[model samples]
Target: MLTQLALGVGILAVLVVSGATGPAEVSPLDAGRVILGHLLPGAPWTSDGSLTRLQDQAVWQFRLPRTLLAGLAGAGLALAGALMQAAVRNPLAEPYVLGVSAGAGLGAVAVITLGSAAVAGLPLSGAAFLGALAATAAVALLSRHHGMLAPTRMILTGVALGSLLSALTSYLTLTTEAQNVFSVLFFLLGSVSAASMDQLAIPAVALLAVTLFALARARALNALLAGDETATALGVPVHRLRGQLVVAASLLTGAVVAVSGGIGFVGLVVPHTARILVGADHRRMLPVTVLAGAFFLMAADLLARTVAAPTEIPLGIVTAVVGAPCFLWLIRRGRAARAGMLR
Candidate 1:
């Protein structure tokens, strides 16, 4: 509970700070007032002279949406990662284990490289969403042996399909005009600079729905960690639960990637970090993972915009730079702990 409170407060602080950041000179207090003014009708802050129209516009219109989107994307990806890791019984599994991100990248790249007309007028986000769903369906079909979903087969098929899609995405990227390469690269690297309130709905809904599903099935997930046979003996319906988790995780990964592009590591890093803090029980770890993911991404997004000053770094780069080191450290720590237990 203390950890959750700290993370929640940290998210709030980062959100306000991110809103205040950028070329415009909106102070943090003014940013907070701007947020409060909008949320609270007839509040004193709404009439306060300290907040200017430009500040209000900058905070509410320009900054908050991207910040909120980052949080949503982070939370969604983290939850999906936890679900995937549990379903596959693999510590390294992430939301992209199902090839969803690769498919999204392929779809978005097709629209960007070939133009909307070539793709039958589908926009980048729409194409990406479709591609993600297509990838999920393909993996689902291929991973089944007879009537059963096989975890090993699922992982292998997803990896094979992801590599194929990535190759295609690369081919499209390379054959395109040199100028369009930058846009394609930027989309692949990921960013939320184009965010708007309207863009928030899909990921937000997916995250909420999946989080609820995960929480409700937390006990089943816990049982699955023991093994398929053990989970089945415990009355967990192993195959059905795993199938549901895959669908839920794919929904989350698709929703996030469609808007935010390919922000990596939130899924891979955040859930493991939550486990380190709160243990592996989904009931306890899920909420912490969601909050921690939101806080982590919001902070990373803040750094992405501010670290390079007027030139914003891509959000994916920031996450990789931070997450890689953290992940390595976690690996080292886990190994040392295991060695000690053996000793």
Candidate 2:
């Protein structure tokens, strides 16, 4: 455990240093340094703003808030992934796995396509939240029809819904504009580069509070791993707990999705990685997942900036590229492990 924590710390340090000491064009290290209090009070974005003052305004007022938002998004999404997996007892369950991303993607596209001038500052987040909520609600309603969530049925519904949303997103992007391609692409792929502190503060606080609440409920979640009937015998209210977790996951996910655009795969990858490191015991698993999510997202964001320089790749792309293989391996290994155990 100490070793894993140390390794996580090492990864974070490497990313931080890369951001701080690397070339200005590729690395956001100077930005991170300012954000982390490396520069004095009079410094900031440029010398004229005063290095401290500039750093203060740049880091505190600008960069810190945005990066922090990205962190929150990562933690929230990863945590949501953890919850979804536990709730359904499926390794493949996540916000995106259920088509929430696609739904959110559709909502943002609606705003971008129609309300670009009428709604600014938060139109995208608003749209995305509504979309995500709508998707979650749809799935919830469908799952409750028979008072049971059959995994295959839920998966199929999500896939269908996600396809519809993806088609809508594509249609909007194509018909909208040649000039607006970059903006739409950024939103679709998810970018925290455009975040502002004022925009991030509310959700950051909300997610943290909810995460603490989840930690408080960790024992209950642990009970859930033992199958619903067994869990009920052990005094866990399976249905009620399921509803509570869904709401919590949705709250965290909606908040993060609103801010980060439709970032995908972090949730799927981070919690699985967390489980691998800390085991399935929610007491250790939950906290490790949260921290792991934070570090993983932060590192990914750093790479998003440095990997392609000024052009900047989206964090979602980085996660998908890295996560897909890891996820495949995870499922394969889980099946193998279960097989061995049965034998």
Give the number of the best model, judged by TM-score.
1
Report the C-alpha displacement of residue 1, candidate 2, in angstroms. Answer: 4.8
Report the lDDT tens digits of candidate 2 across residue range 218-332: 8888888778888899999888888777767776777787878888888877877776666777888787787777777776777887788766898889888877787678656
For all predicted structures, in order, the TM-scores are 0.96, 0.83
Model 2 worst lDDT window (10 residues): 334-343
User: Scored by CA lDDT, what does every candidate get?
Assistant: 0.88, 0.73
The C-alpha RMSD of each candidate to the native structure, in angstroms, is: 2.2, 4.2
Candidate 1, poorest ten consecutive residues by summed lDDT: 334-343
Scored against the true structure, residue 152 in model 1 reaches a CA lDDT of: 88
**Where is model 1 more than 4 Å wrong at Cα?**
334-343
Q: Give the distance in Å from residue 40's predicted Cα in candidate 2 to where it truly belongs.
A: 9.9
Per-residue lDDT tens digits of candidate 1, residues 94-177? 756668889999999999999887667999998888888899899999999988888888889988898999999999998999
Residue-pair clashes per prediction, in order, are: 0, 16
